[model samples]
Target: MIKNEIKIKSEEGEVFDKKQIALAIRNSTFDDDLRCSLLDDGILDKCQGCNLRYICDGIDQVVDSYVDKTTEVVNNFDFE
Candidate 1:
């Protein structure tokens, strides 16, 4: 996978592509107290009872990439 890029593949070998996700994430603000939206931004917690918890590996990497990219974009902005 590309560095700092998020690539999620389905069980059928389909890659998920949503470009606007990065822009949306960069433009939005998240509260620290908000619930951790698994597979939305990042897998902040351990998997307890998901449908494909075992088979799905590298998910944490994708989540980290997305979060890192989003944070990078957001930090680079200087809204004055």
Candidate 2:
């Protein structure tokens, strides 16, 4: 089982769930046509606008890795 976690803080101080952060990332309107859209859009800015930005930043690398791995798995499976 994978445990997704996120912690976001505001002026009042708050914690958020990481899965929610992932959803935000998945739903972001940033142009996906570019290969590095996420990075180009400014990961910090995009995340900062998100409710779970703080927590999401902590797992950015992990999330990217997972996405890459999942894409490879799906592609390989499709080829098979």
> What C-alpha lDDT do the candidate models reach, one value each?
0.51, 0.55
Root-mean-square deviation of each candidate, in angstroms?
10.8, 10.1
Angstrom error at residue 23, model 1: 14
lDDT (tens digit, per residue) of candidate 2 on 1-80: 65455675678788787666666565342333213445467764443466665655655655566567665433433454
Put down candidate 1 lDDT per residue, 15-41, tens digits, no spaces. 645664444343334432222357566
Q: Which stretches of candidate 1 lie over 4 Å from their true place?
A: 1-55, 73-80
* Backbone atom clashes (below 3 Å) for every candidate: 0, 1
- State in Å the error of residue 1, model 1: 34
Which pairs clash in the backbone of model 2? 6-18
